[model samples]
Target: MQYKPLIMGILNVTPDSFSDGGQYCVQAEALAHAQRMVLEGADIIDIGGESTRPGSDPVSEGEQLARVIPVIQALRCHLPSNLLLSIDTTRSAVAEAAIVAGANVVNDVSAGTDDPRMFSVAARAGVPLVLMHMQGRPKNMQDNPGYRDVVEEVLTFLVERAEAAKDSGIRPENIIIDPGIGFGKRKEDNLRLIADLRRFVATGYKVLLGASRKKFMGAICGETRPVELMGATIATTVLGVSAGVSMFRVHDVKPNRQAADVTAAVLRT
Candidate 1:
């Protein structure tokens, strides 16, 4: 019942991120936010340049590269050298650039299905990578998606994809799996996956649950705005801790870290 939570702080450098959008798009603000989150208990900071919100269009690879590199450079130069830096992208070129700029983790929300080169990038980088499970492309994921059994299908996909990544030369220890709570799932599917997350951990790989501030939280909280779903986010973090989740991707770092600490304390008792 012990919790070893790997809190990956969200650093979305986009104009349309659900929260903290445009707020951190400026170089100075972004640097300050990264520093604060690391001080607030973020083991890692996930730097993403593109917005993958519902109905959002994809950014050009060149543009995406431009957005994240400078921020990563600042982080590498100013933040603690041991601070874990993650590039939240599926582009191999971006991955390579981020690594060369000193990022250590590659968090591909596409699960490497979008770009065939993703797995190979992780392999060559020799760093830990997170494979997030999403049903389809971000732009169309919420367009009336249907899955006969989301939990089963998602688990299968994670297993297959993890194996594929391993075969592509990524070691098992260098991999983490995320359920991708809102990408293509309804509220029910997300809940069931959280309830049954131990099955994923049983695979001997770490499971990182990223259900923070998602649309489902708004639906659960009956709020229209992303900021209003924070209480629900805390609840999900507690539930995730109860299920032995290894990491959490969140916008609210201090609250999530505190929730995790309390949950871990109770479970230990």
Candidate 2:
């Protein structure tokens, strides 16, 4: 069987996220958006309550739980039983609460570094954990982001984090690594990662590529608005597919789905 990359639709239930923030803060709106993504062929729905964009202030744990739990609960009740739900959080407490509420995966951008307990939470839950590579905290990651050989540095960081997760009792099979495109990368760095994505894939862990409407697209295409970067996002999706990525985290699900399907078909030929 030809391997088809999975699509993880983004659901940001925060008022300050870089893209589509306040738009889905309401529980009903978030659920509705999730249902739409499911219909659009999303294999997973990633719910994030805090804004991780550069220079963003952190939200309290109480606020993060309040914002995401209700939506996860609602989606669990309304969506199919097999629809994978992923909680995008850096805090262990939030990840625990979300898993209890019905999330099956943890997408931590900090790769278990933000909160020491994050790895333990994933281990206890025995669920898939996405450990992404970011240069620094969201507040300062973009401040003159420097990387010596971006691809090598990111691959090294991901390997180290994956080993740490396994050492923390997280099953090796549950591990996924993401070369975070915009978290703390320059436009050239982002381009280099995408161009050299096969290196991350060769590490033998499932690789996730999240180039969805990021600032690099704006820097390259002169599309400042996040919404205006969908074309660029789709273009990167095609590149990622060719690079053997196992999944894509995207804001616009339908278009990316089509692109991934077509790319997968072409690659098969």
Best by TM-score: 2
Q: Candidate 1 on 1-269: residue-level lDDT in tens?
A: 44577788999999988676788988889999999999899999999998887777889889999999999999999999999999999888999999999999999998898899999988998999899898778889898877898889999999999999999999999999998999888889898898899889888888898988888878767888887777888898898888888899999999999999889889888
> Which regions of candidate 1 fall more than 4 Å away from where they truly are?
1-3
**What is the lDDT, from 0 to 100, of the residue 39 in candidate 2?**
97
Looking at model 1, the pairs that clash are: none
Top lDDT: which candidate number?
Answer: 2
TM-score of each: 0.97, 0.98
lDDT of model 2, residue 114: 86
lDDT (tens digit, per residue) of candidate 2 on 93-150 = 9999999999999999999888989999999999999999999889999999998799
Off by over 4 Å in 2: none
* Model 1: lowest-lDDT 10 consecutive positions: 1-10
- RMSD (CA, Å), candidate 2 to true, equals 0.8
Return the clash pairs for model 2, or none.
Answer: none
lDDT of 2 at 231: 94
